[model samples]
Target: MPTPDLLTGELTLTGRITTASNATFLGTIGELVVVYKPRAGESPLWDFPSGTLAHREAAAYKVSEVFGWNIVPHTWLRDGPLGEGMVQAWQEEDPSQNPVDLVPAEAVPGSDWKQVLRGQGEDGQMVALVHEDSAALRRMAVFDVVVNNADRKGNHILAMTEGHRHGVDHGLTFHHEHKLRTVLWGWIGDALNADELEGIDRVREGLQGQLGQQLADLLSAEEVEALALRCDRLRSDGQFPAPSGQAPAVPWPLF
Candidate 1:
């Protein structure tokens, strides 16, 4: 839960999120900025699914700790213009980073295509995709795959000038299926390195313990099974497993 002071809405009204959702860019509350995602009225693909948006955000934040990426922000349970919502940390936007635009691995110097792909602007213009460190980014991507991140678009990655790429918008994560899709596809078939394998081991160990207990609150039984399947594949193959069945790679537009 977020502290009362962080939950207060005032100066933030001056700003808003450019995304399609009913999101508002709440002013920075500490090291993090807050965003409000109100429930959608009536969408075609999905209809708020009844009552799980905030909880979905909560579960993703918790699962993020296990993955080692800081995508989920500290959410304060509060009422929003739409209804109850989560107040998330604001990620500082930097122009140096490319927005989900695919960059060729060869064009970027010193970047190993096998390990990870560094993002560059479409016209061969140089832009920071995920810092110079491809190793760290690959690990996070693997974690995302393990969680079955339904969305991992390139724009979701916010590259800071100081050499860190932060991910945002995780309200639709942790579902129990092969619903993985996103722009971070640099490591589609590359095998997981040692440290990467070790991290999966940690998550597997945690799943049956306190983590599983916690996931229970946010995931359904089928979803939990999906998570298990992903981990099992990673552990067995040491590489990203192929898609099991034919599933739409992307979500509906309104979502």
Candidate 2:
């Protein structure tokens, strides 16, 4: 399906994603599967303004596009069965691979994975939260930081069959305040490579032009300003940031 069709085609809701904090649906535009989150269905959040999560989701996609890394799936705002909402193309993740995972602490891969932390599992076994040390996931970590994503849980990172990684469920992002909670804290102080720095530079440049204009429409003026500041700070620091603030650095129920 073409972009126009996905934007204007009739949305048919197939089912509800009961696990989502806000009302989320699995739906279709003709033959193309998509995920929808209606504005009216958004639950009131203490920190975020009401009825704006959908807009934040779309804003995240715009920032992702500016980064020139396909960190987020294609997302946009459109009128749907319930009401106006955010819709994103559905991704069929590769089941054979686990990009972010919780494994027995002693069993964490010594080579390919970066362990974030160690904790006790429900079954009383010691487990470790870990994610891949690949370039794809690292890009996603940077993307999450740029967006100030407050809920980059394990399930939100999708591993594709061809090694691509897509981060989803971005409604909890772009807050004016520092709220960078995520499971991708493996590279806390690692220096960002040239390509990563280049991506940050692109975002900084975009904020001076079209990307800034687009975000102004989706986020509050303060939020947009904060987004630009984050890009600048990241570029200036030249390394992955250590988690800061009074709130938890990582989201609960990690998966």
lDDT at residue 7 of model 1 (Cα atoms): 68
Which regions of candidate 2 deviate over 4 angstroms? none
Best by TM-score: 2
Q: Per-residue CA lDDT of candidate 1, range 1-255, in tens?
A: 456665665324336656645354555444455676654522233622555656666677776677665545465456655566666776677887553443455444344433223444658765433323366467657767787777666666677777566666666677665577654555556788887888788778778887788878777867777777778888898886554467655343312
TM-score of 2: 0.97
Instruction: List residue ranges in candidate 1 displaced over 4 A.
Output: 1-12, 22-32, 40-51, 103-133, 248-255
List per-prediction Cα lDDT, in the order shown. 0.61, 0.93
Task: Tell me the tens digit of each residue's lDDT in model 2 across 1-255.
Answer: 138888898999999999998899999999989999999999998999999999999999999998999888889999998899999999999999998899999899988789999999999999999999999988999999999999999999998999999999999999999999999999999999999999999998999999999999999999988988999899999999998989999998798
Task: Write down the lDDT that model 2 would get.
Answer: 0.93
| TM-score of every prediction relative to native | 0.74, 0.97
